[model samples]
Target: MIDSIIFLIKTAFKNVFKNWLLTIASISILSVCLIVLGSVMLIVGNINLFIDEIGDESQIVLFIEEDLTVDEITQISDRLHSISNIGNINYKSNSMILEEYKESLGEDAWLFEDLDAETFRNSFVFNIKDLEKYDQTIYEVEKIDGIAKIKERRDVIERIVDIKDVLTFLSFWIVMIFVIISMVIITNSVKVSVYAKKQEIWLMKYVGATDAFIEAPYFMEGIIIGLTAGFIAIISQIYVYNNVLSPILSDLGFINPLNIDSVMSVIVIGFLVAGAIIGTIGSAYPVKKYLNV
Candidate 1:
């Protein structure tokens, strides 16, 4: 058994070294594929991170009754704070709103000089646990005693929610494309390697070697190739982050540092698995087709 193991090891190495160019070519192609796939994965993750950052403070603004006294509005704000899914509640009076308008518009804010914060009405800004419940929660708020009307951010929230949906769809399509292309490229590489060794495989079969014995070395080669590609992909991703992604994320101001790490982990695992399976399947087809004799 030990001798057989030694032979297999020796043979695997010999094959790997003998087909140096072929091995390099196959691994290189897989490396390139993994890098591109990794980039797509990173982009997907960044989009998700951006969406989540925006969602952390997701809220609905309720417009309070203009005639409601200060005490009444305070009671409503206090009641909202007691809700299960509610986070923090920020109550801004109409006067405060007008001040913010002036600050925002600068010199042009003078156009609204005729209006005071009272014109804007007091709004209750409260967050919810789940964004999907926003509309229902707003409906509930409208029923409150001091709420004359509710001005939930229907337009902006809908746009943000739509972006999340688009990002999720994009992730699926991107993953599908990665799988297909990775399979094609890796399988083609394995096929080429097998083609070059077709005569050797036939000789092994003629010498009474079982299929398992004949396939062992190639399988190991595939794993090694996969590991190599994974390493390359990871290094490439890190380089991209340090030299590209990080700088861009920094400019964006809310980048989560773990995003790149998550992306690299996914890509490395993805490439390794892809490489192993494609190598195994690709080798199987050629061996079955050309070595059965």
Candidate 2:
């Protein structure tokens, strides 16, 4: 078995170099596909990170009637808790609200120094778990008796949600298209490799080589192409991300670009698996077509 495996590997390597042009072409196409896909993954990852950061800061501020007693406030809090999508609800007294306003002003806090702390409205801040159900949550909260006014900037959230949805949709279609193109390119490359070795393949078959024995070398050849392409793609993506995208995003401060180190394992494993599969399938097609035993 070891001898057979060694022989197959040797044959695959020989064929790979012998048909160096096809191998190079296959690697180039596969690498390009991986680069495009990896770039999209980075963009989508950062967008998601930005959205989550914004969401953490986003809140629904329900300014309740200032005169409500402790029991009334507790009842309102209980009602908010009953909502399934509400992740967190914090009650802020009038004094707390005054303190927040003062902090926001910093040195200008003295401008409103004469005003009484009791003048500010008591409120509850609601952190929503699911943004899609925000409107329904708002409607339910509005029906509560103590809520004087509901203050939330849904415009920004809505716009971000729309953009995220569009990006996700587009990325899916783009990935599918690139995968198809990669597979097609690899398939043609393998077909050319097989055509180059047709006489040798026929001679092996005439001498009673089993189907698996005949196909093993081609499978190895495909895997070699895929693995090489995958590594090239990963290296190219890391370089581009650090050199081109990171600088721009770092200046923005609000957007957190993903660290290549953090996501490297996932990228490497994902590409390796995808590359192997593409190569195996690409080589398999020609085997079925040409090696009819």
Candidate 3:
């Protein structure tokens, strides 16, 4: 068993280096495919993170009726509290709204100097626990008597949610297509390697060599190629994300880009696993088709 293992290891390395150009070509293609796929996953991951942050902080703005009494306001507050999925319920008086507007205006606060705080409506701001029930909650909130107008940040959130699914689906298919192409390239590479050693393989087989002995070396070759490709792809991805993409995203205040550590952790495992599977399958196919004799 030990001898067989040692022989397979030696032969696999020999085959890999003997046809260095083809092996390199296969690895390069696989690395490029992996890099593209990793980028897509990272982009989608950050987008989803940003969306979740926004969604978590999202709120409904309920403008109160100017003529509603204190009792009516209390009733409205109670009604809001009674609703399911309600989180924090904050009451913003007209004065508070005006103050916020002034703070936002900064130098332009002078333009609003003549306008009274009473000109702004008093409102209730509500955070919700579940985004999926947003429409239903909006409907319920609208039916309340003391509400003069209703505004929600849900429109933007809903649009982002829709876009998220579309992007994920499209990116998945795109990555899958690239993976298939890479696998085909690797398969051909394996076939070439196998053909180069056909006479040796036949001689060994004739001399009572087991099928496993002949096939083990090719399997190891595939694994080595996959591991090398995966490592290279990860390094390339990190460089591009940190030096190229992250700097640009950092300048954009609205975007919340993912930290490198988190992304690396996921990509490392993902790349290694994907590379191993693709390598194993690619190597197995040619061996099954051509070496079965």
Candidate 4:
């Protein structure tokens, strides 16, 4: 059994190298497929990250009248906490807001020295537990005592989420289209390789070579091609992401930038999967057509 397996591997490797054009063609197609898939994965990851950032920054700040005492504010805080969908209440004191503006102003901080934060608005910041429950959360918080106003930006968040959902759906179809194209390209390339060796294949069959004996070489070649394509695609993506994508995104002030490690992992997995599927399907057509029993 071991001998048979070794023979198959050796034959496959020899054939993969011997048919230089087909081997290269397979690798190229696989590389393109992997690259496309990697791009799709990165897009999805970024959209998800953006959605998260939007959610984090989405806080409903309610401004109360300064006449309210500390006990009244705490009373408001407790009521906000009592609501079901409300995650937590962050009370920004008059002094805290003043300090923030002072930091922002730097030397100009003295401009606001005569003023007071209480003159603006003593706010109760509402963080929702789930974005889907935002409207309901706001409706509940409005009923609380000493809560002057709520600026829950529901429309903005909903619009962004809806657009992203559409993009996510579109990505699925795009992925399917590319996968089909990859399969077709690999299949045709392998078929041509098999056709070139038609005479040898016939002779081997006549001399009692089994179906496995004939097909093993193709399967093995597929594995080799697949692995190579996947690895190369991963490296290429990582380079492009760091050198190209990162700089552009940095200019836009996106947080933490795009993580190369995550992108690389996605690329690697996509390529490896593409390699296996392509090689297997590509060879299947040839085996069915030429290697009967």
Instruction: State the C-alpha lDDT per candidate.
Output: 0.70, 0.86, 0.86, 0.75
Angstrom error of the Cα, residue 47, model 3: value is: 2.4
Judge candidate 3 at residue 22 and give its lDDT.
Answer: 92
TM-score of every model versus the real structure? 0.68, 0.84, 0.76, 0.72
Q: Model 3: how far is 118 from its true place, Å?
A: 11
Per residue, candidate 2 scores C-alpha lDDT tens digits across 34-54 of 888988888888888888777
Alpha carbon deviation, residue 101, candidate 3 (Å): 6.3
- Minimum summed lDDT over a 10-residue window in model 2 is located at 284-293
Looking at model 1, report the run of 10 residues with the lowest lDDT sum: 282-291
- TM-score of predicted model 4? 0.72
lDDT of 4 by residue, 153-265 (tens): 87887886787778888888887887777667666666766777788788988999888788878777767777788788788777776787667766777645768775565
**Model 3: which residue pairs collide?**
none
lDDT of 1 by residue, 66-163 (tens): 88887897899887876666666788888888888889999898898887566688888877666656677666666678776665667766787788
lDDT of 3 by residue, 13-112 (tens): 9988988999999899999999889888877777777776777677778999998899999999999999988778999999999889889999999888
Off by over 4 Å in 1: 1-6, 56-58, 64-86, 91-123, 128-148, 206-208, 249-293
Q: Which residue pairs of candidate 1 clash?
A: 94-117, 95-117
lDDT of 2: 0.86
Q: Looking at model 4, which ten-residue stretch has the lowest summed lDDT?
A: 262-271
